[model samples]
Target: MKRHPRRSVPATLTALVLLAACALVAVVTIQMLLGETPWIRYDTVAAALHGTRWTDTVTAIVGAAAVLLGLILVLAAIIPGKPVVLPLRGDLDSGASRRSYRSTLRVAASAVDGVSDARVKLKPRTIAATVTTGRTTIDGLADAVRRSVEERLDQIDPAVRPTVRVKIRAVRKAS
Candidate 1:
């Protein structure tokens, strides 16, 4: 299953633009029907269109901007977003959200000895962990944390096993 987040921004902006355009037309139609002048007259717009030349810098700039905006909107609508939930192995019959998965790995790293704190960053195929210890000398803390994280990852049994990388940071001693 391909599960990814839907981009709401483009849809929202498009809806708002359509709504405004429709409202503007309705307002103008009502004014014209009432035998009064509209805020923006269609004849004025026609005159402006007739007066402007394609070679004019202002017209060229406006055309370029419109084209760029259209391309951006099309790309935004077509591009796939990052997956929010990663599927687990078949036997598990479940999925883990990015947040929950990262937290589980962080808990494993923090459970190790001399690990005061753990910060986990999840990428597509790598789980990078930074563990902070109170001790100034961290000889094998990074390896221990990596092993802890990897063991927990195995237990989770995700569909794709990301490599574990652990970085150890020690709290500075008081002067």
Candidate 2:
């Protein structure tokens, strides 16, 4: 089967990291099971495990289980990086998070009489609107965009104050 060349390095590193993590976990688990301090181990751990075959067997089984679990997790991440890597917008900490919100604002602003093109940016506390209105001075166009956005936002959250910036990129007569 054809494989993704880019997947190799990350997959190998993930496997290595998983192996090391499993080893560390096994060491810590064995230490804890033998009544040693979590961070610093006591000499009693070796003595107790050496004397008790049952404890030694349990430690071996648990260590193997942890190693197998870690390997499985590493393989899972390596096989499909999509689940491990979150989408860009998924990390957003904002109210207007949906892509449709920005696109809608742009389309809605451009639908106005003088607007030629528009871009909308939304953040947690503020919304910024930039419009290219077909006029020499964008003051009137900016006002229109602000009003439109404010009305829309008021329906959602009346308290939100938007900053609308209109730049007259180009002017053309209506056909």
Candidate 3:
């Protein structure tokens, strides 16, 4: 089963609020059972409910907040989440994350001679590589990097073979 990422913030807050409310109710019930003064007086609550008149501004604010909260919950439930990792052919049981792919591409590109450093970005449909070369200018370095990255990607066998784009830059010497 594919595991979905959780939106924990709202869920946790809601749980805490519910727990507190339940605890308060439990405390009130226990007090009434034991014949002790209640933490919340029922008479005060009844009076407040029966006699209090809500102002127009307060009612409007409360209604807007409720509507906004409902809309947020609905939208969160409706939207589909993007997976952090792309599934590989070999690892059906376990998947490789995009970060891992990026690192692999960087290493592959850096393996090429004349490439001092490599930076790789893996997108849904594109693999971008930037390589820095030493003082010597290597002809076709960009093409070589692109080919190397493409080859590495072929080994992974991603769902979609992204187009490889390579950019080569000469390393700047310190003055």
Candidate 4:
């Protein structure tokens, strides 16, 4: 019953940056071959490759740096760690909150006989939710969801009392 941890933003961003760098390098290489602007002077560079020139050395260093930077990015994404979880601020937590009570609540709701989607929102004094069940009545499915949620919460806090409201957002048409 292990829930998948969310992806890390930094890691994801690093991965995207790496991909962009690789793409940029590929595009630049293609442009160099095609005699495009900015990359229009490969012949001179190739000639420089034959000589012991400072420009050739600088170009080699820059290329190496770019490759090393890209490698570092790919490594960052592959490192093992839990996804970053930013805590809700005190102000936000005290207000009408919608934190998932537990994974079971979502799993249970999703498992309901006719529910296509079940999203539960917990507020100060009530639990407002929406369920998408093609063949299920909204009221009946909502009540079921509420009961399931309450039952799950009761295990932790027996005195937990919250009004439950269920709304049907959409029903998929059968083909």
- Model 4 over residues 1-175: C-alpha lDDT tens digits? 1122544676677779889988877887888678777543667767867775555768789889989977876666565443223133243422112334534456666676777887776554676667778872355766777677667656534233567676766575545
Clashing pairs in 3: none
lDDT of 3 by residue, 1-175 (tens): 2234576766777789889999999999999999999999889889866764566676678889989987887777666565566766653565677668789889999999889899988665888888999856567888888888888888878766789988878876545
Ranking by lDDT: 1, 3, 2, 4
* Location of the lowest summed lDDT over 10 successive residues in candidate 2: 81-90
The candidate scoring highest on lDDT is: 1
Q: Of the candidates shown, which would achieve the greatest TM-score relative to the real structure?
A: 1
> Can you give the TM-score per candidate against the true fold?
0.91, 0.40, 0.71, 0.37
For candidate 2, give the lDDT of residue 35. 80
Superposed by TM-score, candidate 3 places the C-alpha of residue 27 at a distance from the truth, in angstroms, of 2.6
Better of 3 and 4 by lDDT: 3
Segments in model 3 whose C-alpha atoms lie over 4 Å from true places: 1-4, 43-55, 90-94, 132-139, 167-175
Question: Lowest summed lDDT over 10 consecutive residues: which window, candidate 1?
Answer: 166-175
lDDT of 1 by residue, 1-175 (tens): 4378887888899899999999999999999999899999999999999999989999999999999989999999888777788889886467888889889999999999999999999888899899999987788888899889989988988998899888888896635
RMSD values, in order shown: 2.1, 15.8, 3.7, 13.0
Better of 1 and 4 by lDDT: 1
Ten residues in sequence with the least summed lDDT for candidate 4? 89-98
